[model samples]
Target: MARLGAGGMGEVFLARTASGRPLALKTVHRDLSREPGFAERFAREIRTNDRVRSPWTVSVVDFSPPDTAPQWLATEYVAAPSLADWVHRHGPLPEPAVRCLARELSAALVSVRAAGVVHRDIKPGNVLLGAERPYLIDFGIARAVRDPRRTRTGTVMGTPGYLAPEQATGAVAAAPADVFSLAAVLVYAATGRSPFVARGEEPDLPALLYRIVHDEPLLDGVPDALLPLVGECLAKNPEQRPTAEEVRARLETAGEQEWHRVVPPALVAAAGSREAELRGLLAAAQPPVYAPVAAPPAPLTPPVPPATAPGTPRPAEDLVAAPSRTRKAVLAALAVALVAFVIVMIVPFGGGDGDGDGDGDGKDGTAPAGTPAPSPSGQSPAVTSLPAAWVGTWTGLGPGTPDADGVARARTQDFAVTVTLHAGAVGDVMGAQVSNLKEIGTGRNLGCTEALELRQMRGNTAVLAAVTSHPTDRSAAIDCPRGNLYLVTMTEPDRLTLESEGAQSAGAPAFLTRGR
Candidate 1:
């Protein structure tokens, strides 16, 4: 009937069987199907899903043959928004709701374990807030408890911020890991933030992994009633963490009435409307046309921002109705690409040998790769100089509104940047900077100090590359994206605009004035 969502593996759609029963159909990406051993893994998930039969899980209805192109698996369609979606669009669930979520998800895990399965991936995005109870979906990375297949060393699977300490270190996840992840999800439900989250900053992949392995989770916001049980579930040692059965037993089961009281009436109404729309389309004389789903649409009305400590940054996505949790999940997936790029591209710019030059390689850095060269000289070519009009310290505050085609596309968060550009050549090093920037889509503030390298300059614009970026605060531990390009174009002698060409969540261009 419509596209449900997409992920790293493939696209999902709201499909139907001959009997008109709605199903969530996931089709493998053609490119992913070509990867070695992908088919086997997909088949394994199908087998795993078939083995577990629980009211808390979306039951698998049918699947494609292992040898088929674009292999697919169809499961019962869940009209409810995911726990991540609900928490993101609204706010953290109240204490009663968190308790109910914990109890139900624990039961879901228990069922999977009894079926000899280990759900390696269990996070907010995988949990749906059904009218009756939450439903655990997506077993793409699940493994049979005694399957005997070994994962490669140094290859970790599962989302960060919810990974068990062992899983963070690339150890195979077991039943205990699922429990740890469930606890993490419950933390997110009780509080608007991930347990491993750094104060006032968006969740960083590297930092979350490190904290999972070495640091205690920030449990300050978890409700008092669920604190002890959640703490035990998050135990660093897998053996010490309670089993799924134990976790289920500890929490009182929440009846349907309790669930109704906890879930937002509007969210349930929205889901009901969506189901009605699907059914209407199915009854029509013509089949409904399906298009690729863009970022899930924001709610019709803006939600109230969740309350936080005075200095803490609220999840900005809540400030206005914008793209939902899909944005966060997509950003989290960037860790895979970020790691690969760092190893290949950023390694050359590793922290320099104590001298002021920022290049890590012993040799004085050459001109940035694409710079137009001056006539060859025996000595190192003199560094180019920035045009007089382009040199200055420019500052701009993002109005939290995009100005493209004179239409507001996405509502961005408050973003502010102060750029100090010095007259220098394409590879000359600058001192450093630590800017606090809050971009749209990403839910938290970002503080990064970085070494700047002039990369290029066209007629009216000069390009600066963030060669080395380190987080300026403990709120986030990972370094900012290296080699990010900031495009500065001069609108007037003393005024300019800056647009980030790299980070997608960098938000709209910021118009700036001199000496602000």
Candidate 2:
């Protein structure tokens, strides 16, 4: 068994399946399982993770059935190292590499939001550097996009230095919180120090939080182009931040071949060497000796059948080689980020359930497929009753929309969206400079105008069954399959919701209200 490292929740191990397929298995510490209400909380977290499916975000593969208690969760293993490992080994990244990292990380957030997930942990240790693309790993603390009331106040979660000012101050960590964390990670990548790091002094958690809430970042070393945008992300006001899509649009001009050669030769050689060792481990006559730790005994050899494979992504070498916790940079054994301040293990499902996520693929960026339809309070009515409140301009910043906080928090870009519904059909536009989402080309404040007919309405649910032509909009993908089948449900008289129907879900149900 190739033991990769440990995290706040459990130990990550590299193991093989019966097919010899590689997987990364994180076994929950036995102590946590004994806690009251842990079983229910664990099950809910799995469901939330299952909703996220993106090439950029690491995918969680389930080996346990619905009824059985899962001892572990497995994810696709990539051969790479944490962003921290690479930066520490190779020094700060060049402008081109940083630009590439920003773009890819933004794109990854695009998917993460699409699946209604806000990864609370966006630190360097959670980011994996692949052969070409950078992947967002460790969705252990991800929360679904929903009504904000569900968040626990003063949770005091996540990494100390990476925590956004709002998060540090015990405010709700919506999408903007993630944006702030990602920006901090970028600063570290570009300058070898967190933007909040005080010069000539050891980093202090409380002092850092105070500075984050009240001070401006010292980023003299950052490129002129990225300075303001990243600063905006680190803004104390969450509403002031831009979305991930917007960031991607701004950086889109950086270049298409940006991802190439982002890695230093030394790290690449190290990765190759680790891969060779992993391959050899598959056939070793005897497994390596277990180096015991003060905590629970390290597994003699990781239990097989459904373990995370090594030489897999985030190669065992991917983690910094510190004995206690390899996965993260600062604390390896206690994997949770909070700098040992406060770590909460339970996965809290946000708020009230709404309409179903139309399909399992998550492409249309809808809700989870099995969201409990409104019951009384939530139940869809048997009669085909349409409320007049549906007519009006509904606007909110969400995935694919500029100024979308979800994109901002995910360390991605933003595209604002506005839709006008006139009882029968709806006209909508998202983004700027580049308005046509079907065939995306980033631009500032550009509007993509398209029409979707509300073909059916039942109870509080309304389905946009077909797309209509907008002859003036050149941004539309003329030849592509672009008719929108996304669902829009009205949970309340004044509230409007939009969700995807395909495999790739877009940043949760885009909750909107009339006129802003």
Clashes of each: 0, 70
lDDT of each: 0.60, 0.54
User: Model 2 segments beyond 4 Å from truth?
Assistant: 63-70, 142-153, 254-256, 283-516
Cα distance off (Å), candidate 2, residue 294:
42
Q: lDDT tens digits, residues 306-394, model 2?
A: 11454334433323232314223322322231111111122212210111222122232121222232111111222333345666777
Residue pairs clashing in model 1 are none
Leading candidate by lDDT: 1
* Every model's TM-score: 0.53, 0.53
lDDT tens string, model 1, 1-516?
344444444455555543345666655556656767877666656655666778888666666654677666667776666776667668888777787788788889989988778888787777888777788877644331112222344655676677788988888788899999999999988886679885566654566677788999889888887899999999999999988888888885445345667766776676666556546555641221111112111211111222343543444435222333434443334322222111100000112111122222232212222222221111121225566555567676765544422111324455666677676777776534456655345544555667878765444445577788877655764345555556555655567756554323334335777784
What are the runs in model 1 whose C-alpha is more than 4 Å off? 142-153, 253-257, 285-516
